[model samples]
Target: MDFGEYDNRKNRKVESGVPDVCKSEPCMMGIDEAGRGPVLGPMVYGTCYCPIAKSSLLKTIGFADSKTLTEEQRDNLFVKLDAEKANMGWLINILSPNYISNSMLKRNKYNLNSLSHDTAIGLISRVLELGINLTEVYVDTVGDFNSYQAKLKSIFPNIDIVVSKKADSIYPIVSAASICAKVARDKAIKNWKFIEGDLFHQFDYGSGYPGDPKTKQFLSENIDPIFGFPQFVRFGWSTASSILDTKALPVKWSSKKAIENSIKTPVISNFFGVQKQETVKEKSHKFFSERCLKSVKNLF
Candidate 1:
């Protein structure tokens, strides 16, 4: 059999890339991941398997891509689907920022994408362990959909993988998987806060997405003084590495009297020039000013 030619399609299997069992029976599983790009959270994988007969129920349950749903909507649907489904499983693979940083250094690879694919494979393995017969699996594409499918297939030789650019949006089950993954990941992150108290003081850090200013600030504030970057930061990243070479100079502040005196005193442009006549003030004013200036300067 030429496995290269089999393909997964909506109602009908294509001549190429179609699984032999899918021709006789539809055994489908939807796969997705959450927290792939987050620098401070765990990467989660979700897989939901249902018989072909129940596929329509997934749509009725309001399952779509997790991205398309608001947090509240996703939370609602996640609870509903969790109670409704026959067999649903999830794997929350915690990837700390420190672990990610080390992985980048040792493997010379981007931790986000690496964790995404790893989590996807992990869900697939769990599905197999549950003894569910999986013929074709649909997954939302992260990077190179085909490459991700190939990687999954390499690990599970007989598994037929269907990877689409937005499979989660198209397939209800994939969307459900996305919701489960996201909800699980969010809960895990919240729980982590209690466990790692004060470690991540800036709560506004918004899940470490690149667009979040709080996340950037958190990273900036945590840099190692000697190494110039935090041990938990991905130093290989340009943003983290740049912090190492940059230094913030200390800012000096002067007392009010010192500032006033400095402005009043004529700055000598050339020491060799004849001394300019000094302006004299009232005896009382001069004495009080002198005493104040002396006291302020001594305080510093």
Candidate 2:
């Protein structure tokens, strides 16, 4: 699309010399994500791509592991990226907490790992569609590295793909991706607009981690009776689940058996009008337990 028009903030993307970046020169792209562990805010997947020869320029610009850099340092690097738009390009996908929670809560259960893998694959495919000649891709991962790498290889057979635990520290390009992703996630949390009320009015949920006392307190106190917390909270997380199950009203989720057996099917004896009384064996609690176990085992 309009790569030049893409902005960095507010979940914007930008690129330059589209055709040249697309297929005219061999390029390498780095993939990294932020906010995966957070219970609040959106998870951001970011990818940065450049011509293979200029990858070293990433180090020259002071791009390194995002975690090691201070917030100001990350901002400065992004500023440099903006200045050198011709050589570097990046894009990001912001995944809302509501979307993540809903995915996991679905009947078929699409977990976070699956969502992450799909998002990364989508980013790579999007770059290729824009006509960028992506020859190699390096990705940072918290899950199974080999499986994720294999999955990317299966999808993009021609391109080389490498998935590592801390590739963000090892690869400059991935480090760049990490910075972009982190900045995007931080902005999302800071700029969060709550549907219930003003975000600033709500207690500061520090970093949205379970270990953060502020975050825990915010989650425990801010839970809504009807809607749960605002859109920024991942309600399906274990932290939220513990509070909900014990403190909030009980909620019964439907299952396959519950849906199919809304009304119990009448036995043949009922149709025949037979008056078979409950036997002494059937009256015993153990007999009911045995019958329930049989039914459960049948389903499996």
Candidate 3:
């Protein structure tokens, strides 16, 4: 929860100790994401799993909608979650903003949906590899509900995959995951350290949503003109990209492939393949050169 070195761009994971239920009996897991809509901070993927027979215990902890709960309320729920560590397990994957921007902006263009899918798949795969007896997976839908459901089923044919509209609110395990994700995201943003410079030591950038007035003002006031916004912002986002296009100086970058292709090659370079090019010589070798009497093998 400390989220030390918040400015680091690396992706990271946090998890609870393996629950006894998961290893001993068939389990059901839920997957949910947080911070997907925010213009700032890392997007988080969280998963929770427990014995199918005992999953109802999660509901008793009042793990409903995390968005409706106060910060203190959510924190209390998270504490309760740890108390149930013997019966259930939770894991989180934090995707840094810079990483999100770079992945979306790269030449091949990894879209957000694909990123989300991969993250969920990876978390489940990791849990299975750890020898958990996961029998079912419930997920809040991404993109098309059925398509997403099918994709997950293909990857985990042996598991019952349920991709629904709002799994977090409907399922106890997913609600647990929702709380874990929200708590981690809140802690991350509250502790975010700007690695850019001292200028942002105490500046308040509220909410980190594109529509938030404070966040908008903070972004507008801090534009670098030459470098655009700091690395804390997702440059690939349209909210930031528009500012760069209109306010920040235009930066046209030559791609690595373009730069490599632009280098001039010598006109004769092709002639020096595996063998060196030899100069023209007398037709009859050294004897013809001395006598100027070239012997023609066949005169047409």
Candidate closest to the true structure, highest TM-score: 3
Compose the digit string of candidate 2's lDDT tens values, residues 128-154: 888888999999985899989998999
Expressed as tens digits, the lDDT of each residue in 118-150 for candidate 1 is: 767876776565556677788888888888878
How do all the candidates rank in terms of TM-score, highest first?
3, 2, 1
For each candidate, what is the lDDT?
A: 0.61, 0.77, 0.83
Error of 3 at 215 (Å): 1.2
TM-score for each of the candidates: 0.64, 0.78, 0.83
- Could you tell me which residue pairs clash in candidate 2? 22-131, 22-132, 22-133
If both were scored by lDDT, which would come out higher, candidate 1 or candidate 3? 3
> For each candidate, C-alpha RMSD in Å?
20.8, 11.0, 15.1
Residue 89 displacement (Å), model 3? 0.9
Q: How does residue 203 of candidate 3 score in lDDT?
A: 76
Q: Which of 1 and 3 is ahead in TM-score?
A: 3
Span of ten consecutive residues with least summed lDDT in model 2: 1-10
Instruction: Name the regions of candidate 2 deviating beyond 4 angstroms.
Output: 1-22, 199-202, 252-300
Give the CA lDDT, 0 to 100, for residue 31 in model 3. 91
